[model samples]
Target chain A: MRAIFPAYLLALIIALAPTSVLATDDVEGAYRLGGGYALGDTGLRLGGYASTEIDVPRTAPWHFSLSDLSLFLTWDNGSRLHFFSELEAGDLLSAGEDESLGVQNVHFEFERCYLDTLVNNNLTVRVGKFLSPIGQWNIIHAAPLVWTTSRPVATENLFSTHATGLMLHGSVNVAQHLLEYSVYGDASETFEAHRSNNPFENAFGAHVRYYLTDSLQLGATYANFVLNDLQPIRYNLAGLDLAWSYQRYELSSEIVYRTTHHTTVENTWQGFIQGVAPISQQWFVIGRYEYFGQTQADAGQIGLLGLAYRPLPPVILKLEYRLGEHNEVLAPDGLSASFAILF
Target chain B: MRLRLVYPMLLILCLAGFPAWAAEPLAVVTAPDYPLSSLSLDDLKLIYLRKSQMDAEGKRWIPLNLPATDPLRRDFSRALFSLLPEEQEEYWNIQYFNGISPPKVMASEEAILRFVASTNGAIGYVRKQKVDPRVKVLLLITPFPPN
Candidate 1:
């Protein structure tokens, strides 16, 4: 714990040293600084501007509090390396499930750490832990960076926010169209479970993306991941996504159909349509509608609405509300507000 | 008819003298066979921008630009990218910062000629008279006559 402070500070200095003095500083001028804060952790749950539950009616408790601080540094070339590590100090004093999730564990994890290098010319290779480049949206997964607080159910079914491994990503120009492609080989030591935010055993996946246009993208991914020593379920995900972004307004949708080797389990599918419209240059309104069918026994739909304020190019502050429903134990519905920063 | 012969002959002689007054414009050098066929303005934009690679016949089109400061480079950008000199700088700067390197640029017209002559799909432009058996011209960039 003591080591992290000095190391982080040193990194900050090294990264911030004005490179303009150097002649090759074409990329030295582009760097961003950002972080987030929340006020409550009790029933007043909110992450950033995650969602508004009342408008849509979700019965679950909101997860909000003072948590998740980050700093992002980028460069002039689209190639970027972002180190997003969150320190949840709120739970430090909390005991456990008994007192409150204690911060004593001081759980430290890297949201992203990668070096994006464009090889020779066209090919780009990303090494280290980074967002899985499975789809257009997953690569830029951040609460503050996004218009909506809650991502669609499709994202949940398709891939995770971060993946650790080497990603080969680049674009090729065909006859008249541009074909953007990415092939990733992930080798993360551990994986997070989907439900309950539980820690699962080690997991890994292979992902790919093909862009039909500047805005529209088609993707397919496969994960031969294991969970809790259960027979490794061969998870297969095929998805179609259409996204268009302009200066002020943007819309993106992802529809994924998931199938596994287990025949007893029902094939599942989910989708989401997310839209953001700028009210002004600095402020915007965002909304997302998500639906998923877990199995014959359970399925639900969710809606999210939020407002975002960007004071600068790379810094974003958002306030959001989300409403979603499920079939059983935890409650028929849930909502959460979250604040996330992107580098 | 007999009386008008002298006036008609003088008019013909006057018309014949005009060619001496206006020198013929410099001709462009391009590939003779393929002739850069089927590429629209947008297609050319895509090719030059490195979004499109293969030429119409599937030969990897090595679209070469002159070095940044070269006159030929400016001429190509002005004609194709449709950008003024300042705009071209900004346009390439954004792309450069976006992690995209510009197309390969040769040092001089002779360097382009040598390289294009050696490589099968290589492409470059030069004066019409500079053309020879060593290379093939694919297209032309004629200058607009001054008003």
Candidate 2:
């Protein structure tokens, strides 16, 4: 029932698009006639990006894996009303036997849909489903927006990826430095979109970042999680992050510590120093060496040394060798190739 | 006898040193009134290659780059990156993943000169001979100069 609703709504939008474009004066930056035939303007913005990658495991035979193909639709009806959304379908062309009784699995899943009010650009609150403001990666988290399509291992596991709830965020300039802050409260029943049946827990988190210069930043965040899943567990976590980048070289790191059972202090650290050089205008070379380790525990160690080329601003291709120690079972050593673009 | 002979050779080597590496034309100039000044090896890397967004006097500053294949561009790259053939790749790839775009490239010294001259708040490097009245020279760096 839920899957059919968006399809019907998308159909409705398609039918109404002609009327919207016929009523517009001209095609501009964010608003234009779809295929030069629709009357669309005054409040709609359309943009989308896609990515695909193939990996060869250390021991298994080579195979093709398609991870992502997505579309974005957003609207900002001037000041107080807005909507942003994405529909993504991943892992389309994998060679595997179907496990589920009878489903081809080709449907668009809504990753984000939110309505925001702009209280003067700098301060505002949003309600709906959106990327969590818990850590750095979640804010500019799209694949094309980031240098590497895959995020740091720590970024994937520790930070909350998305949430359904309310978030209050604001920014200010203090003594010439820019500072941005966010606080969010989410209901645990809305965990992982697909697994949202239980409704007995709630979580809250806050993050603050200070931009020191055009190429450097300092940020810190603290979050406490409480759950009521039969046996409740409470976690107190804090993190400190710093980054410096210039030209084709950059250095960055993050440290996260959490306390559980009221006294045990466990910490994990991740960082990397990388450099990018242009071999030619059409062909640029990239190299990176990164490491993240856990203290007092064998937090999995992952390092990627790779190179990439850009055919144009909208297209990028790369080859990388990824090696992980400590998690021998997950990913031993592998070579991967990927392509991504946004339009 | 040996000391006297070695003395002239040492003096000659010093004189031939940097000027040979970075010789400048006698009367070349540049363009673009102000976005950049007193550019060092570090500043060049930060401004041009990094594509860093900066604000000065309410004017947005943008740095441009020469074509990767241009000779003068090779000289500028050597001076700025200071890396051998193998290290430059690793040097730049690290920055790519850091969410920074490399500088946009133009065809020639004339293209660079024309671009900096026409665009507001633009900065670039070119040959001293190519410098003209259309732009402003912010810094003068050469292998050697008459002191």
Candidate 3:
């Protein structure tokens, strides 16, 4: 199954290529810069993004790699039903600083596949696999949309990044303010598990976000899950996050803590605060600080400063330097650069 | 002498108001039979931003947009969101990644009028003077004063 997935994806892309070309002639002005190509009047659209990164570590071998190549398909019935899916192939090729280059064994996985049914103006029911709505970063983590090349540790480690099952999500307006909520659960294993993923067996969680003002939002999340580890430990997790923007400057932060029911020594927690300030219309300066700790491992802290340039909305170039103490594998101390484009 | 002075003053006043009079007012239009007769400014904002998909009646609202470079589009965006279409690029980028696309873009106001008139639940904006009986006008927007 794992080996055939890529072949299937290749065939799908090949089949869609001619349709996309025909769509350009059938639909007037069907293509936009970042937006996908509409498949005639059928309501289906095809789009994707790609990114490459150069990693230079202080004590490790430097390398350059094709980090992510992702494709997505979306269909809207123009009424009550909508469908979306994303397939990603990561680390397709790599070259070491020692003048060696080769095609790396790639990991192909379905990042998101779901159907959304509109129940009303204030509610939507979604079934299948979707990004866990725990915080803002996880859902919009695409390379072209984010400010930095590296993700915060807390956002990736504290909970299941993807949930396979069902979710009920909605938003309502109250006195000119917006309130959004989601409740989701997954009882079975992931549909197509990737070796790098930390899949979970059973989990349920809820998230709520309130827009205090047009530029400020606060969110809270809670979840309980059994990690698919060798011993299958059960854990409870909680988190809080904030996002605020004034003009072109922005600030965001999230903190997550997890506790195991079987052992006190295995509890873990992490937090981070990131800020982006616009230097000009297309240039930005970013700074972030993070701290991660586990009961059984050395606690670590890291700080990063980066600059990003967006020549266009869907194209970005980033360079950053990282410094840290008691660093873990995820938070390496180094300099990294990346270029990404969404089409 | 008094008559001459009054004539000059009147001429200056007319000249000062010429731009405002020549500026075309925009109208939010939809199918003649679209359920709602009017939409609040807040609702319009939400709909265009893709924050609100369905209306109070549980029917979807398909919003249409003019090309970003169109003068009418610039005026409409400024009047509706207080931002130019170019300024909202970042917002649209994030929305695109989340599988929520911005309103479909039409080539011209004529295309918008034709689409909105024939399609149910369709909504678009066009010049008030160009509005015909084929579409129903929901809201009228006057261009903001230039800075």
Candidate 4:
């Protein structure tokens, strides 16, 4: 299996590395060797994050994978301009799949690499490939950062997750309320599909967000693009996302609808609501419910329950169970647990 | 007789554990030449989180923090952010993923004080006792009981 080699390598590294590297003094910062370190006072930084996961579905065997290994290169410039770049190797190694599933031995990609120019306190310009600022999860989808092992279907299925072009983003305070917006357009297929996760081409999108306070946020997104899967199809999608958090509890939800310009195909709408409550400083529980509706297809509902534990700041352990109705063929009921880390 | 003596000694130990302690106040200070003389709690929170980069005057603002485990830093974060250690960790992880890093961390209050006092537009927090006239106090956070 593809996961065999990476499993051995990971085991060997863990066995050989010094435990003192994770000493108390160095734990806040990344482990000294693989940690995020500033390059002197030059404003440049080097850091990386990696995560491996294991999953078991009702219909499939246990799946073990080296999910993501990424490196970050950033420059603050200490001025109005900044540079950020990320190189990712996803599905770097998988223990349970063949080449037919698009799971390669070492799949390298440029997840996001961009340049940002701040015009002022209220306006900025960004150029290059960046994550599409759609739903909340689209921007913070890293495994270790999210609470559960499974991502909501709407976050991925409704629109392209990445855009390659220029964007204008800004935020301003209006009567003590924060108003934020971003507009982006793609002139051509700038990113190679194989080297990047570019699902669409010739796209234009806009996102507007209003923050009543630090705890609450509401946003809307709209995009039009030509799908890149096999035959090119024109599609328009719109979404709304909401997030609110109190001391120990948080709620997030997103709704998306998409349709093709040509009228024969069915339009689809999907949404999911998820809540998380911290049981203690190191542990939390989560519940999520989701629904999808199609014009001429069977509608479906899904429910998930999850528990997460953080042994350290950069490490997370998660266990999740899912139940689905009317979408059993697409997403089988399953239980998955994973260990993820960020550094 | 042995049991009675033991009970008296235990009572003495319990009394010793409940001594009254004074809560330390924290001063958020900036360089003498810095534009602002005082700041709101909202502005302070935004600055320390690296969400805002400039003062109202459009001048750059550099925020500094003490090492994570420092008692003073812990107290300041608790009173201001109302976040636990694990929550703080999660917050930092999200920021890192979004291309933002936490403020520069100094080893001790003296280092933070020195940095803020010497650098223009720099800000840091220290115990009220450590604050000197070299830096301007922008805000004072009254200590809350540690959780």
Candidate 5:
């Protein structure tokens, strides 16, 4: 049943394409690179992105896998109401020298499914499951959108990535600057839990971002949640992030601290700063450093250097190497490469 | 000797003014009944970037664009955002992942004018000469001096 969900979605989207095209008087050009196909004047759109990765670690067998295949649908009523949903199929296939080439256990999950009603210019009410607006990276973490193939621990480990409930979000212009904010809460279990991710039973969070300049912005986040465990531990978290870009060079950083009420080791914290510089029109040099301190584990520090090339706007190729003092599973020392596309 | 000096000065003036003369003027246009008469450069930038969706009156805006390769689009982007369409790819990618698309693109300036004139809240850019009475010119943009 899980494996067939993606197929069913794809079929549905394809089936509607011709009908939508025929209904509209004017149809935009066939297919755009990153821009999805507009399902005519119906206010519906169909699109998705996929990524493949190869990993070579010193302590483990080298492997190649289809990391992500995601399909998203969006509907806008040409007014205040909007709907969006994304379904992802992960780890679809794998191959290695020691392991035979074959289909692997695929994980299917709904990344986001939400309805947004624009109450006014200053506020929007969103209901359903949506990405937790904890930091810049997590909200735009699609494979083709981010600079790095591997995510920083701080972005994922300290908090739940998705929340199921309600969110109020909007942007306002204060003076000459732009201030954007989101306040969300989840009082129920996650809609469809992915095995790899930690979901909260009850959680609430707020994120605020202020644009200091066109190229730079600062962000703050706070959240409190209860873990879905037998013991039901309660945790509180706070995070800060910064992003700045000028011409072809960019710099971004994020830091998060989490505290639990029930544990003797009360706190865990992590952070990373990343920079990207253009080497050529289609190539970029990327570098990053990360630090993580877990409650009952040795502190870990990692440094990474990478290169990315984009032959086209919607496609990217990346290669990177990671080295760290604590070469554990969370921060393994290895070389990795990926090819990703947004269509 | 005087003629030579005059010739050089005239040449310099023409060279300095070449960009404004060579580039076509653009009209930021919308339906004739659109609530606002004009838009600030900041608001225009936000609309094109998909950051600002509603106007001061709380009406949703339907921002439109030209094809990526169109010279008019290149000029519009350069004049408004100081960035080329290619340079905006990364930004659009992030928006796409978040389910916010870039503005819908029309095939030609004529189509843009027609759409903007007929549809409520629709706004687009076109050659100044191409705008007709049916549409309202919200703002007039002069081409930037070439780098």
Candidate 6:
């Protein structure tokens, strides 16, 4: 019942879109079907993105699914105040032949809803739920924008992907290099339903980024969180990320470590290095290797090879093959393909 | 015989047109009211790419662009971003997801200059020959990237 509200809101907005569709004449630029329309002279804009995936594994049954359908609404009250909201329905449809027959895996929920205000030129304050600015992937994980059909297991499982509450962020220039930082805290369990994806109850985190050059960036993040369950377990995490690009060649990597104390202390780490190159105007080749380890379980590594073609910037066609050692049952070696579009 | 004749003809045409093509220069322009009269190439890149928002005075700086199909616009994008069209598109896709849009686009160089001249924070670029006294020249370079 909690999910019904977002579904209705999405339907209502989409239904009301056509009336202002004709008034969006002056917003002349590339027209993408998935791109939202500017609502006349108002500051409101609406857009959405969706993706479908097909996975074929060696031992398990092939799965075909509509993975994600999400809509975003942003309202800017001039330069001072901004509002952003996202509603997502994941695993909306799945082939019911075998594995998915009795799986109740569908979810409709609010992903992000935040209000941001510029306190000054160098500082901004945000209130509400948002993607944790821990690393690059967590913020920009939309399928159409990401290169691979599947996400790195390390990235998905290492940290809390979203948080609810207050965040303060700013950037300053120091010695010709831009330094950016964000500190956030989720003190109260106010929006429990909206923040179900957040694994922690009380959390505080900070991230800092350094832009050494136009082509190079380095960042570090730290967070302390408490599990919301009966016996609130305490945990501490640290992460480092790097991005570098030169012309058509690009490289990015991220590594994160976590430690938790309940009865005793345990430490775990995960990381991945990804490289991408454009072979032609429309084609890009990508490769990535990832490692995941824990004190209790055996360490594992996975490698992926993929290629993507973009007929248009808003549309992407991706195919990848995965090979792994250590956890084949959880993340099987398989061929995955997906077509995604952002409008 | 046909091949030999076409080769020399092509070479002659290339030799004759090279100097004329290379002579055109690009002029980066901002409003006269803007404090700084000149900018480094890196500064220009930051403004055009929407990575930087304010001028030295703390007032907002608005970047203007020409229509994508215009040759002058193509030249500016290729030279400044150092990216192919597809790569540029990919870059903008990411930007859009992050809630930023491309710079405002004008219809012609005259419109660009007129806008820049009237708007205090406006910035745009065009062929050097088309520049007028209305707008201040921030930077100038050959239309083609330096080889």
Candidate number with greatest TM-score: 5
Which lDDT values do the candidates have, in the order given?
A: 0.50, 0.55, 0.82, 0.76, 0.83, 0.76
Across all candidates, the chain A TM-score values are: 0.66, 0.76, 0.89, 0.85, 0.90, 0.87
For model 3, residues A22-52, the per-residue Cα lDDT tens digits are 1111124567778988766666778989999
Write candidate 2's Cα lDDT for A130-163 as tens digits: 6656556556555554455446654544444666
Candidate number that wins on TM-score, 2 or 4: 4
Residue ranges of candidate 6 with Cα displaced over 4 Å = A1-30, A33-35, A99-104, A191-193, B1-17, B20-25, B34-38, B56-58, B118-120
**Residue-wise C-alpha lDDT for candidate 5, range A197-229, written one tens digit per residue:** 677778999999999998999999999998754
Model 2 residue runs over 4 Å out of place are A1-39, A60-63, A96-108, A190-193, A196-201, A226-232, A262-279, A282-297, A329-331, B1-147
> In model 3, what are the clashing residue pairs, if there are any?
none
Tens digits of per-residue lDDT, candidate 6, A122-206, equal 7778877778787778878899988998887666575677887789987777787778889999754655465566366778999
Candidate with top lDDT is 5
Q: Is the docking of candidate 1 incorrect, acceptable, medium or high quality?
A: incorrect
Which regions in candidate 5 have their CA more than 4 angstroms from the true location? A1-27, A188-196, B1-24
Summing lDDT over every window of 10 consecutive residues in candidate 2 chain A, give the lowest-scoring window: A30-39
Off by over 4 Å in 3: A1-28, A97-99, A190-196, A264-266, B1-24
Error of 5 at A129 (Å): 1.1
| lDDT, model 1, position A75 | 31
By TM-score, is 3 or 4 better?
A: 3
Query: Comparing candidate 1 with candidate 3, which one achieves the higher DockQ?
Result: 3
The C-alpha TM-scores of every prediction are 0.53, 0.58, 0.89, 0.83, 0.90, 0.83
Residue by residue across A80-171, what tens digits does model 1's lDDT show? 22122322222222222223543554334545444555453346677555555555567555444455554565675534555656677666
lDDT of 3 at A12: 51
Tell me the lDDT of model 4 at A46.
79
Ranking of predictions according to DockQ: 5, 3, 4, 6, 1, 2
TM-scores of chain B alone in all candidate structures, in the order given: 0.62, 0.65, 0.86, 0.84, 0.85, 0.82
